[model samples]
Target: MSIKIENLTHIYMPGSPFEKRALDEVSIDIQDGEFVALIGHTGSGKSTLIQHINGLLKPSSGKIIIDNVDITGDKVKLSDIRKKVGLVFQYPEYQLFEETIEKDIAFGPKNLGLDEAEISKRVIKAMNMVGLDYESYKDKSPFDLSGGQKRRVAIAGVVAMEPKVLILDEPTAGLDPKGRDEILDKIKDLRKEYNMTIILVSHSMEDVAKVATRILVMHQGKCILDGTPKEVFKEVEVLEKVGLAVPQVTYLAKKLKQKGFNISEDIFTIEEAKYEILKLLKGANNND
Candidate 1:
């Protein structure tokens, strides 16, 4: 599913004294099967913009076209759009309420009126997609699991819905390093397996740099930058101006380059930085 937003603007409490603009004439195009990472500081319209994508919120003055249909228009069914676009909120594990893990994951498919056999199949598939073994965790209480396991279950619930477009808002917000990697790896695997269009709203520049095929930077209710991670993170000064920081490795690489080291300033990950340093060392040894 491709998504196109044209002149999209959204406001809260439109005629009231406390009315505020949350999205300001933001326009962007998201192609099918693209992994887009949306980044911004708090109050930058990141949350507000995504809500419009799945019909949770309407545009105040523009149009949102999903798969060539203008979803913002009155004739469009919001429910239908929602079924195609699944959103997993931050700390989604807190919302789990089923007696068993399988039931929690089966909830969405069950709600869709899928047959018993199909719903069970979907629940198992979804759990497996998130690295959970159906036989091990099926009958366990969600609240009794670890933080990361609970989160995976929560994500599996959304995955079972089989949305073409999956949007996650801070999926790894409170996870430990290992837990974070698990969630991110599952996301990567899901994209490859299903060819789903993924829009991830994240605060960790390191996480986005590692996984995002494209990055969208927002500032004060507007989309200020959009490009590949390399392209977007290269503008360190601009990002800093908006109270956002690029990955620490990118910063280290930039400083090293400025100090006359033979290193690439565009590096975004620890692995990349390590490779560049090793290359520089090899060059030095050759000259010696």
Candidate 2:
């Protein structure tokens, strides 16, 4: 499903001494099947903005249109909107409580009142999507799994809901490097395999550059930048001013360029940097 936010504004503690504008006339359009990453430092309004997408929070002013429907309309059911847009918050494993993995993953589908057969189908499918084998993990306690496995189970719970759009906030927070990579791979696979529009709120520029098709930079309650990864990371000065930076590899590439190397500084990934450096070495060898 597509999402369109127009002039959205949200205020916290209105009329109080702590009144703050969490979102300020922010606007964005996310098309279906796009992996959009939302990046910003703390207090940049990234968290607050995702909460408004599925109606968890209401906009103080402006409109939210999902799939051409005005979700901000008074008569629209927030519950329905939520089903179409599943949100997995940071450290979702902390929310797990079921005795067995299957039960935990089945919670959302069961809440929808599906019959036993359909619920089983959805549970198995969701587990498979997250790389969990239903035959082995179905009866295992969620708490018994490794950290990465537990996270996958949490994400499977949302996947069972069959949402058209998925929003993940810091999905890899607090995990070791290996675990983080596994989760990111699962997220990438989910988007391609299910064609779900995904909005990821992240702090890691390397992760964003690796997977995000587009990036939206949020700062001081406004969306300061919006474009593909290549486009957004090009604004190194603006991002640094907001306490953000491009991928580490991008900075390294810039340093090489300053040394008079025949390499492009626009490189965003380690793989790209390696390729460019190898090509430059090949040219040097030919001249020798």
Model-by-model lDDT, in order? 0.93, 0.94
Over 80-113, each residue of candidate 2 has an lDDT whose tens digit, in order, gives 8988999998989999999999999999999888
Clashing pairs in 2: none
Candidate 1 TM-score versus the reference: 0.97
- For model 1, the stretches where C-alpha displacement exceeds 4 angstroms are none
What TM value does model 2 have? 0.97
Indicate the residue-level lDDT of 238 in model 1: 97
TM-score of each: 0.97, 0.97
Q: Give RMSD (Å) of candidate 2 vs. truth.
A: 1.1
Give the distance in Å from residue 29's predicted Cα in candidate 1 to where it truly belongs: 0.6
C-alpha-based local distance difference test score of model 2: 0.94
